[model samples]
Target: MSILIFSLILLVGAYAAGLLGSLTGLGGGVVVIPLLTLVFHVDIRYAIGAALLASIANSSGAATAYIKEGITNVRLGMFLEIATTAGAVGGALIAVFTPVNTIAILFGLVLIFSALMTIRKKNEHAEQTGSKWSYVLKLNSTYPTANGEVAYKLKNIGGGFSIMLLAGVLSGLLGIGSGALKVLAMDGAMRIPFKVSTTTSNFMIGVTAAASAVVYLQRGYIDPGIAFPVVLGVLGGAFTGARLLTIMNPRTLRIIFCIAISFVALEMIYNGFNHQF
Candidate 1:
């Protein structure tokens, strides 16, 4: 394809990726990387770099809206970010020496896990009074609602912090925000409300992505052509998705997202084993 044609096609694809990501709770980077490497024939490293840029763009855009809504737990997000930021830098540095095929396989596996996590039914946990750590760290906070602000408790701080570290490593390695795992850490481990978990995850994603992005830049993996189209398209699509979410059936969208992501993830794993990369 000519440069103009390639750029246009990528822009469209990235937009679709972003829309689906927004609707399904997967970050745009998950879809963006596969499209670039598998369909567009971009190198894995370059695709990762572009995906990281897309992730940062999407995170920043969504976070602004979430923060404005007063649902984001800024103190909790920032404190947990310390773990993710450290892990992201470590993962990014490790990516430099990792084989391309290995990276592709690992990414595919993580995608499969993410897909499964999305489609599964959620179990509600009763609010905990909170562990001593939550009191000491002051991570507990309230969110706005029609009635008014209602306070929430935090729990299992040690476990949640440990999980955040792994989430950060995956974010750096896969060039994604790892939003799902971050939510898992907060909602599942820390016993935070779902709204708080999601908003805080979005709040933290940009910082995690930025940490890894610095390493990717040092490695010279970033391409201006790919990054520009991916970032612009994802931001545009994310905007449209926010509107669609108000009207769409979230469960249906999640199922569709899970299926689509699984298919691409399997392809990535297949190609990796076949030495296509």
Candidate 2:
């Protein structure tokens, strides 16, 4: 394809990815990778590079709105980043040598799991108590509500931290923000409010992607032509999505997240098993 045609295709795909990513905290990379590799016939490594760039843009565009709204727990996100950044560096180094098929299969499985996890009942109002660690670290916080700011607390800090490490590893290996797993860690394991988990995810994904991006750059996976269009499109979409998220129903958000990921997961898995990665 001509450069202009390729760039246009990437821009459209990345825009859709970013919108869904901002709404669900999945990050644009999740969509960008599959669109690049499966539809555009790009190599997985180059796709990863583009996806990482798109994800960082997605995070930056959405995070500002979430932060301004006070829905994002910046303190918690920063605390969790310590683990994710550490794991991302190691995973990026490993991705340099990992097989493409293996990475694709793993990515598909993770998406499936994340989609399944979204089937649960309401979580934002789940009764949770602050764990001792949360108290010590001061990670507990409040978010806006129709009535006022409602407080939430953390649970299973150890479990959440462990899951965050895994999220980071996947982020680096797949060039995804690992926002799905990050949501699971905080929303499910830690008992954080779903809104808080998602917004905090938006805050953290950029930092995590940046950590691994340096490694991808060193390995020459980042292509300027692909990265530029993807980032530009994602930023535009993410900002639009962020505006809608504040008024969106949580249940509706879950449905969108599940449907999007499930479809992509199955397709990715089929292609990976067929040695198409």
Candidate 3:
């Protein structure tokens, strides 16, 4: 492809990725990497770097609206950041020596799992009985609803933190936001409300991606030319998605995410096994 045409394709692709990611709380990197590797024939390392940067932009752009809407738990996100940052650092270090095919295969599996999890009904109004850690750490919180402020409580602090570490590792290793895992930790493990979990996950992903992005930058994985279009397009899309969050039904977005993720997962696995990527 010519330079202008390639840039246009990247821009459109990144925009779609960011829109779906922000809307579904899955993060744009999941879509970004597959498109880059499978469609554009980009190298995984550079694609990952571009995806991470775009993820940072998407998360930050969408988080402003989510935070203002009172769905994001800032304190909860900060607490989880401690574990995520540490894991991200470790994962980034390991990514340097890991085989490309291994990364692709793992990415495929993660994509499939996330897709299934996305379509599952979330228990948003589970009991508010707080765990000891939830009480101590103030993980129990409330978010505004149409009826009123809906209260929720954290369940498994240890489990949530452990899962967050894994999320961070995947983010760093694959250069994606890994927001699906983050949401799973909060919504599934801690039993946070679906909206709160997604918004908080979006809030936390920016910090997580940034920490790992530094490692990629130092290692020379990031390229300015590729990052420009991806970052701009993803950021714009995220802003648009955030504006639409209150009006749109999340189930609709989840269905869309499931279909897209399923395709990407299959393609990633095919590429990994055949060494086509």
Q: TM-score: which candidate is best? A: 1
Cα lDDT listed for each candidate: 0.88, 0.84, 0.85
Once fitted onto the true fold, the runs of candidate 2 whose alpha carbons sit more than 4 angstroms away are: 23-25, 126-128, 244-257
- As for lDDT, the candidate ahead, 1 or 2, is 1
Q: Order candidates by TM-score, high to low.
A: 1, 3, 2
- Whichever of 2 and 3 has more lDDT, that candidate is 3
Off by over 4 Å in 1: 123-126
Per-residue lDDT for 166-261 in model 1, tens only?
A: 999988988988888998898889988788888889889999999999999988989998888899998888889899988877897688779989
In terms of lDDT, which candidate is strongest? 1
Worst 10 residues of 3 by lDDT: 119-128
Say what the RMSD of model 3 is: 1.8
lDDT of 1 at 79: 96
The collision pairs in model 2 are none
Q: Better model by TM-score, 1 or 3?
A: 1
TM-score, cand. 1 vs. native: 0.96
Candidates, ranked, lDDT = 1, 3, 2
**Cα distance off (Å), candidate 1, residue 145:** 3.3
